[model samples]
Structure formats: structure tokens, C-alpha cells
Target chain A: MTTSTTPRVCRGIGEFRTALAERLAAVPGEASLGLVPTMGALHEGHAHLVRLAREENAVVAVSVFVNPLQFGPDEDLERYPRTLEADLELLARCGADLVFAPAVEQMYPDGEPLVRVTAGPLGAVLDGASRPGHFDGALTVVNKLLNITAPPGPVPFRAYFGEKDAQQLLLVRRMVADFDLPVTVRPVPIVRDADGLALSSRNRYLDAGQRHAALVLPATLRALAAGELDLDAARARIDAEDQVRLDYLVVVDPRTLAPVAPAPGTLALVAAHVGSTRLIDNLAL
Target chain B: MTTSTTPRVCRGIGEFRTALAERLAAVPGEASLGLVPTMGALHEGHAHLVRLAREENAVVAVSVFVNPLQFGPDEDLERYPRTLEADLELLARCGADLVFAPAVEQMYPDGEPLVRVTAGPLGAVLDGASRPGHFDGALTVVNKLLNITAPPGPVPFRAYFGEKDAQQLLLVRRMVADFDLPVTVRPVPIVRDADGLALSSRNRYLDAGQRHAALVLPATLRALAAGELDLDAARARIDAEDQVRLDYLVVVDPRTLAPVAPAPGTLALVAAHVGSTRLIDNLAL
Candidate 1:
């Protein structure tokens, strides 16, 4: 059967897993596969990731699951974007072979419970330090997805991830290694606009002026990267800005996300309020 | 392949899982299946559980894995007995369809540093209360085994467990529910000898007199079940006995494994050292 633009969709993890297995089986010898697990509201960033997977693998499975586990009780789980039909069309146009759009019930049938993947020493610092249990959710869901899509034999599978969520990517890599899952995790570069705005589905919540003000994040990160500003000074400069409400601005080691002495390979992550929308962006130094 | 008496042994979880899948596929349509996951050194207790699975399901998969995750840092991991050849022979005689003997590397290839299925309230109480990380190990390995052996499609699968370790059984059941795994957990009666000694692989460590003294566990449990003693008094009585070091004795609810106020459906469990070997036994009150 020829691939369809509006790809075949499965609603639950069980059904999706079964369907994926069956579909993958039809493809001849050792399918070179890549998975782009995401919460679907396909922006330019998501498109870049899908493109990367499409170019790299014989088959690309893009999972659009708005996992509730990762979100805190008071967070934006309820308000998170849900554009499935549009997302599928976009995925198909971007050359994704399969678009798995599972519901909240499908991803988490067991309800709101904790499945933690300990971050060791690094977990207690950086983003993990600020948001408790956040890395746990990311690791748990990623582990489930990896298990579900694991090849039947020793054949290796690669997972495509965006570097925008740097900490999440690191933790996922850790989980794959720690669990010995036969899958390689490849982190794709962050896709940004000409104005340096990192595209996010949550970006939709920004109003016209708020969207303009959001540019300060990319600007601050760029300033830090250019050696024009120190870490604390850059953070203070961003904080002193009137329009953007700074949530967190810190520099740390890119891999461990631990606070370092401003050495090379440091990641400067920033989260702030640009109007009602919370915008998060990071730059590697 | 007509069930081999010369056990078809595998060295890893992946290999074992692949072999099991192929074996299950050979079976004719929609057969009921049961799993009896175990650490090797198969005794009457494990054999009886396998026998029950054979009677219950059209296919029975008996997993023999001495899961290292369940062992604590200072625990007897190295000294734990491994008789894979003998275990398979025993299973073959017991009418088991498949003997899934996976190697330590197979089950935990990348070193399973993280565990699964933690007891929320029931954990810090009974056996969990005493052993610390014991139930976490038991639950994690059991979860992995269940996922590995879960039946395809809507029908789900059933697993048979011995009630000799009442707390372990309760924790496993909770994990199954919490994860919404499509498997029914059935706890079978504790298999015993003519002398009323609960069968265990650990019994191999006991000398003749120590083996005889081990009978006090089941004997004491039987006495409690017959209304010959109260909970605390029974524990104190067991503690007072000679030639054995008492670990713990408590009457708890069978389902929760929580200390019950002397209710009927309660289970009285005893753990003690007979010589250098630790023995545990339980009886439904």
C-alpha cells in the first residue's frame, strides 16, 4: 500500500503499538526507523525535526501525544495546544511515514501517577532544580515510547529530538543508556526564525506586542554567546527589561545541566512570560 | 517442536523474548496463556506454580531469572544458587510449555539502575517496611517480565504467583492495576512438604537440623490460623524459640499486607534464620 498524506492514526498506546508493529512488518529487511515523539501543534521547529527523521530513516514515526504526566497539577496541561487534524496534514506534507496521535487516555491509562527516572547529581541542579518532577515525566514517557517501538531483533532504531528542550534530551539519552534500550537518540539543532524567535506551539498564546517582546530571550542568549556579556550580568540585563517577565535565566553545562564556572559547552536556558504565554528558549555556549 | 525435556535455555531477555514470541506464534488460535516468573533453583513451590499455569492456560511461560535488581547492596546476590539445567528439567517434568531462562545480562543488559512499581502506602509497612528496597526490586523485575510476556490483542493474559510471599503477591497485584497492564494476577496456594515446610530455594542452604527447625515458621503460622494464639503473643512466642533467629512475625490483611486488627481474612507471615539460611512462610488466618 502506498503511503497516504493523511497518515493512518491510532488512538491508544496499545493500538498504536500493535498497528506500528504490523505496518513496520510489511517493509522489507531491517527497517531504518526514526521516531519524533511530540505534543502536536506543528511549528517550524517540529517541521525541521520531521524533515531530519524523513531524510535519515527508511520509516519515520512521529508520535503526537500531549502527555499529562510531564505537566504539573497547576501547569498548562488543560490549555496545551491540540491541533491533531492540522498536525497530521502537516506531518504528511513534511514526509513523515506514520503519524501516531494518541489521546491522553491512551498515553496514560493508569491516571496521574509518578514514574521517576532519577537524574543523579545533575537532576538536583538547573531546570530540574527549578521544576521538581519535570525530568521524571519526560524520562518516563520517553521510556514507554522507546519500549513500544523497539525493533523485534537486535536491529537498532534512532530517535530524533530537538535541542530546544536540552535538559529533556540529555535525560532521555541517560534513560536509554541506563535502561539499555537498543535505540540511539539523536538531537536535532533548534530551528529559529530570522528574528531569532524559537518556534513553540505555546508561542500561539502570545499577543502581537508580547510576541515582539519575546525576542529579548533570543537576544539575551545571543549576547551571552557572543562574549559581550557575563552570565549574571546577562541575566540581570534580561531581568531588567520592562516587557519580558523573566522566570529563570542561568548558565550551566550543556550535558549535565549543572551549574558550571562559565566554561565552554555551557547552556543558557531562559523561561519568561511574554503576555499570558510562557516562552522558553535556550542557547548553547 | 514437541516440548523439549532438554531445556532450551537462553542467555538474555531479548533472546528469550524472541524465542518465546516464535513459540507462542506456533500455537493455534486464541489460546489462554499464563506466566510464572521466577528466579531459578526451581523447587516444589515453583514447580507447583508452573503446574497450575499448565492446568489454567493452553500455554505456560515459566521465566527463570535471578533478577539482580531485587538484591540489595549487602544482600546475597553472589551466593544465590543458580541451577538452570536442573530448573528446566523440573519445568519439563511439571508440564510447563516454555522455560524462559534469561541471563542476568539478558534481563538487564545496560544495568537496570532504575526500578519500577513502588508501593505507595503498603511499601513502607510489612515486608517493605523491613527489607527497604526489596519490594521495589521485586515489582520492577515483575513489571518487565509482564510487559515482555503480555498477550497480544484485547484478551490480555493471566499470571500465577505463589501466596507463600503474601506481601510480594499484594505488591505485584497493585503494580498490575497501577500500570493498567492487560494481565490478571492469580495467587495460588503455598505449596508445602509432608512435614509442613514451605518449599523455597533458600531451603537448600539449611542443614538437616536447620531444615527441621525451619518447619517452625509454617508450624507457627498454622497455629495462628487455628486460633491457638494472638498476633503479638504468637510473634513473641516465635522469638522466644531456640536454634533460630526471628526476623519478623505479623498478622496483616491479605490484600494490602497491612497490619489488620485480628480480622478473619488476615495472613500471618513469619521470617526467620534457620542456621545461615533465611526462611519465610505465611498462612491465611
Candidate 2:
């Protein structure tokens, strides 16, 4: 059966839940629900995720919530990209059945969450180190999205997240295991431009000159993956590049995110400010 | 249809999930599942919770885990009650459909949870102030239990907690609201003995003299609730009792748990050390 090109847009939590439930119940047997959660910049990466979900599940629900809880006081919450109309068009082409675009009030009717899912020691490193509470906010919203999309009875419920946010993907997997949440996590690889810059909504902030400087992020990861430079050499290479200010570059165990000797399955992660916009990228060594 | 008198005892997480799912699937229509979370050492109070679950839900699950995370280093982790056999017996009598009694390792296979549900400022007051991270641990385990027992599709799922642990009940309600968990929280009233002493598993630690002295806790609440004494007088009354050490006595708004003048619906909470055992009780003023 062909899914309708025009996916239903739900702005309220109760409406979305009820709509999804009705759709799932109408499935011939037990239905598998797939969720692609995004902040709604609707890039090629998001399209790839939605297409993958459409191919795998009986139904796909995409949540386009730029969660306020996940943003620091000084962060780009206001400046964060929100292109809902364009997002809906892309989701339609990608075969999404529903779009859950809740306003901040609908998602958090009770103001700030008193209880939140906290990422322990691991959350204090990398992006978390530079932007405190970033992972906590990301993980908390992801947790909420996962619960929101969960089916009433157990069939197959899976959520698709990009591997570009490697730390987030790892922490989300950890949370699912920790909470014993009944959804499976499917990781989609990092989608990059032809020039090899990893796709990010924040990439929109880059100027023509800053965009060229940001290539250092992917170049640093490629060099580390190719064994052309060691950890210190990688850091120095990014530091030497004009307009690219290195935040951190380290090779660590993918599972533990702890500094380790570069080896297969270890991940090389780098963050840099290309102009005023910060960008992060990772590569498996 | 009669539920089996001998509730299936599941020792593994996977086993319990599978067993519960299969039972739920067997229900003629959509099934409502009820959960009563406890730390074993079954008392009449637990039976009351289970019976309420029995009355309300198509299937009932009781989790008997004395979560180590909720206990502090200086507190009674080693000495906490464990009466699983008796607990199972009471559950069976109370018409519990299933008993999930996982080993610490089974519930937390990867040691302590790296990601936990934290009760914010509310967690740092009353019981939280006395025992740091206590509510955080309680909330984490409770979050896990709700997720574990959650059905695949949207069916009615509720978890029961006694009002005896007023702070815990309030925090659990908050966590459920914050997480937007699929489970409903069912609050059962505090079950007291004929003499008016609140039932507690830790009451097992009390000697005859301590047990007699523990009466001061409920008496203080009674006096405060009945307007026989104000907050200051209630503290003094509990302090004057022989062998009773006052911990804290305050009248607070039930919703916010903030200090409020004595009024109907405000909760009067009392905690004290009767000999070596610490006890807490609350009454609605």
C-alpha cells in the first residue's frame, strides 16, 4: 500500500498520540512504528533517515521539535534553524506518514521538567565539556520523543538517529538499555556533502569564508582515519588552520568514550569553531 | 477467567518481559496492566496495593527489588528487608498475576545505571535532604519499572504506590508527568495498624521500646493535623517523647512540597529516629 504523499501534521501531543494509535491499529497484523526525530532544518541527512524509516517500518512518524529544555541559556535556541514548510515537503518526498511538530508549550505543558534523564560521567566530555548540559538536554528530549512514539502493545518500535552525533547516539543507546525502554535504536551513517563536510543544521550559520575554513573539520577526521597524523599532530593541524579554532580532538574508545591508543573501533572526534559557529565531526579509526 | 493463584515468578528481565507480553496478548480485548513496585518483606500494605491492582487491571505485575542505588553508604543497604518467599505468598493471595523479582545484576546488567532519572529541587528536600540521591535512585528504578512493564501498543498501564511515602509518591507522579510515560500512577492510601503506627518494612529493625516510641511519629502528625499543636509545638512534642529523636516536622503544600500554613489538603510530614530505626509518616491537614 502506498503511503499518502501529504503526511498528517499534528501539533498537539494528545492529537499525535491518538492519530498514531489509530494508524497503528488499522495495520493488518502487529505494526512496526519508526520515528525520525529532528529539529526541522530538513537537510539531505534527515531525508536519508526518513527514507530509511519508510523502507523499514509499517508507519513512520517524524517529530520536528527544537526542544527548549536541551538548549543552554546562551546557546542558539532562538537562532536554531526551523523550516517546517520545507521540512514537510521533504518528509512527503521521503514517504513520512506523520509529522509531529509540537510547540514548546505542547511538549512541556508543565514548564521545565523537574525530573530529567541525566547522562553520568560520560556526559562531561567532548561537546558536553564545552557546552555543559548539552547532552543532558539532548538525551532528555530524545528520551521524551522515544516515549511519545512508543506503541501501546509491543510490535517493533524503532527510532532512527544520525551517527554524526556519535556521542548522542551512544548515550541514547545507553539510556534505552538503562531504562529498558521497548524501542530499538537504528543508527544511520553521517551524510556528507560532495566536498566531505558532515551535514548539520548549524552549518547554515557559516559564511562563504567560514564554510571553506570548516572543511578543516572533515580533513582532520580523514587524516586521523588514514593514519597520516597521531592525536597531537591532528590537534596541531587543526590549530594551524586560519579561521578554524580547535576545541578538542581526541581518539577514544567508541563504547566508553575514554582516551585510548588509536585502534580499530576507536573513534576520532573533533570540534572546532569555524568563525562563530561551532561544528563537530567524528570518524571510526 | 480466573488468574492462576500461583503467580509466575520471573527472575530475568527478558523472561519477565516475554511472559508479561504473552499474557497481555492472551487477553480478549485491549488489556490494562497494573504494577505494584516494592522492596519485598511483604506487609498488609503491599497486599492492599496488589489487591487494588487486581481489582483494576486485567493483569498485575509486582516488582520486588530492594534497589541498592536508593540506599546511601551510611544507610541500611546491607540490612534492608528481604522476604521474597513471603512476598510471593502475599502476592499470590492478593491475586497478583506475575512477580518480577530480578537479581541486582539482572536489573542493572551493566553495574549501576550511568543514565538515571533525577528528581530536581524537589528531590533535595525532606527525605532527599536527609538522604542525598535517594529520590534520584528511587525515580531511576521506578522509571525503569514503568518502561519494562509498558505494553507494545497503547493500552492502559498503571503503577501503584502507597501514600505512606508521600514524597516518593509525589516525585513519582512528577517523573511520570515529566517523562510523559505511558503508565498511569495509582495512589493508594497509607495503611496503618490498629494502634495508628504506619507500616514500614524497616519497622522490623525496631525493638519493643523503639516500637512503642515510634508511636510519637504518628501522634505528632495527628496533633498537627488536628490543630492540637503548631509546627514548632509538633517538633517539641516529638522531641519530648522518650527514646524518640525528631528528624523533621513540617506542614507543606501537597503539590509543591513547599512550607505552607496548616490548611486542608496540606501534608504534615514527620520523620524521627526511634532507637536505631528511622521512620517517616505523613497526614493530610
Candidate 2 residue A34 Cα shift, in angstroms, is 0.8
True contacts kept of each: 0.02, 0.88
lDDT for A83 (candidate 2): 93
TM (chain A) per model = 0.92, 0.97
Q: How far off is each candidate at the interface, as Cα RMSD in Å?
A: 4.9, 1.2
lDDT (Cα, 0-100) at A188 in candidate 2:
97
Best by TM-score: 2
Tens-digit lDDT string for candidate 2 (A95-153): 99999999988878889888898998888899889989988888888888888888865
Could you tell me which residue pairs clash in candidate 2? A151-B152, A151-B153, A152-B152, A152-B153, A152-B154, A153-B152, A153-B153, A154-B152, A154-B153
RMSD of 2: 1.4
Candidate 2 residue spans exceeding 4 A from truth: A1-4, B1-4
Q: Give the TM-score of candidate 2.
A: 0.98
**Which ten-residue region of model 2 chain A has the weakest summed lDDT?**
A1-10
Docking class of 2: high
Q: State the lDDT of candidate 2 residue by residue for B29-130, as single tens digits.
A: 858799999989989988889989999999899999999999998998898988888887788788898999999999999999998888999999999999
